[model samples]
Target: MRAERRSGSLMAAPYAAFLLIFAAYPILFALVLVFLKWDLVTTPVFAGADNMRMLATDTRFWRAVANTFVFLSIHLPLQVASALMLALALNRPLAFRSFWRAAFFLPVVISGAVVAILWSNLYATDVGLINGVLVRIGLRPVPWLTDPSTAMPAIAAMVTWKNVGFYVIIYLAGLQYIPRSCKEAIEIEGASTWQRFRFLTLPLLLPQTILVVTLSTINGFQLFIEPYVMTGGGPLRRTYSIVLYLYTNAFAYQKMGYAATIGVALALIIGSVVFIQRRVIGNAEAL
Candidate 1:
């Protein structure tokens, strides 16, 4: 018994050490850094809650939070509906099913930086593919990233388009788990297609719905690469995300302490929002 226990401990020790070095230490140090000032060039000096205080009152930080919520409001529903619809459409027996699935998922496997760059051209106001289409349809070209009102939503839409393929795969996998008997029974009970989906298919996909909401919400909060590469958090700072703001603080402003504070606050906000969303969704499921 002693030898077995010792052997298990030896086997797990490397992973435990790795976690301590990579995860635990960084987390602890980040928390500590939130109270101290350091720019990597100057000596670290303890500021003691100043960073937190500044972050709490910073209007720009609040604006970033508000912008994130705006992005999510548009991104989340669009993502869920688009993914679910595509999943539903592809669920039935269709020609070249694997090919269709692969095509849809191709964008998801692409790098975010590449996606952002690709979309930048597609969204350019004067020479964009979107603008060209609008002009061909006799409509005025609209500035996607150049207008404050449209910039964030444009980014949200691009993100949705980029990630919908991944979530489609998710919903597709969820659709498979739904019992065929349940679907057949609903149809036998004289339920319309909409009713069947509303009652049976939708309810059964609760876990996937929860996953989509949580993952998309976290992604919305962490939006940096898209805005950074595309808009540079520009067009009146409409697309400025929290992560972008944090990066600006750390790199440009040399406010490492405040950046860590933003990180901590972001983590807390994400955790709380996801918790509330789960509770709400769970209660809805129960009802």
Candidate 2:
């Protein structure tokens, strides 16, 4: 047993070292930087809690947080509904099953920047595909990326489309584990399709649903690449996100200390939000 333990430790040492170097070290350094003002070229100076004070009154930062909430409002439900529906369809035996699955998940494996750029063109006003169809039908072309009201929603829709495949895979895995006996019993009871789904399928998949919500919420909070590529957080900053603001402070504005503060604050906020979500989802006794 001792020899086996030694061998296991040896096998795990590389991963432990990797995490210490890549994850643990960076996080610890960022926490230290939160109290020190230092541009990459300057000697670090202790700033104490100045960064935290500035963050408290930072209206722009609060706006970015609000913008993220708006994005989540749209992205979360759309992601869950679309992914669940697609997964249900895919679970059934269908023609070209592998092809359909591949097509859905293709965007998940593709570069996010590439997906953002592609959607940018598609959402373009004048010659873009959707607007062009609307124009042909005598409707005015909508400024999707350039309008404050539409910009975040457009990005939300794009993100949902891009990631729906990943969540669909999650739901699919959950579907596979549902006992065949439960399905057979539901059919024996002559439950209608929707009733069976509501009473049996959805309730049984509660764990997967909770997982989908928590993951998408985290992804929503970490939104950066899509808005950066598509709108540059423009159209009156409607698409500005928390992570975008953090990136701007660190790289664009050269406020490393404040950026670290934002990073720390973001971590806390994510933990709090995810905790509340799990509580709410956990208390769902039915439906």
lDDT of each: 0.93, 0.95
| lDDT per residue as tens, model 2, 1-287 | 99999999999999999999999999999999999998888899999999999999999999999999999999999999999999999999999999999999999999999999998899999879989989999999999999999999999999999999999999999999999999999989999999999989999889999999999999889999999999999989999999999999999999999999999999999999999999998889543
TM-score per model over all chains: 0.96, 0.97
Worst 10 residues of 1 by lDDT: 231-240
Q: Write the per-residue lDDT of candidate 1 for residues 79-198, one digit (tens) a residue.
A: 999999999999989999999899898999899999999998999999999999999999999999999999999999999999998999889999999988988998999999999989
Top lDDT model: 2
RMSD of 2: 1.3
Residue 37's lDDT in candidate 1: 94
Go through the candidates in order and give the clash count of each. 0, 0
lDDT of 2 at 102: 93
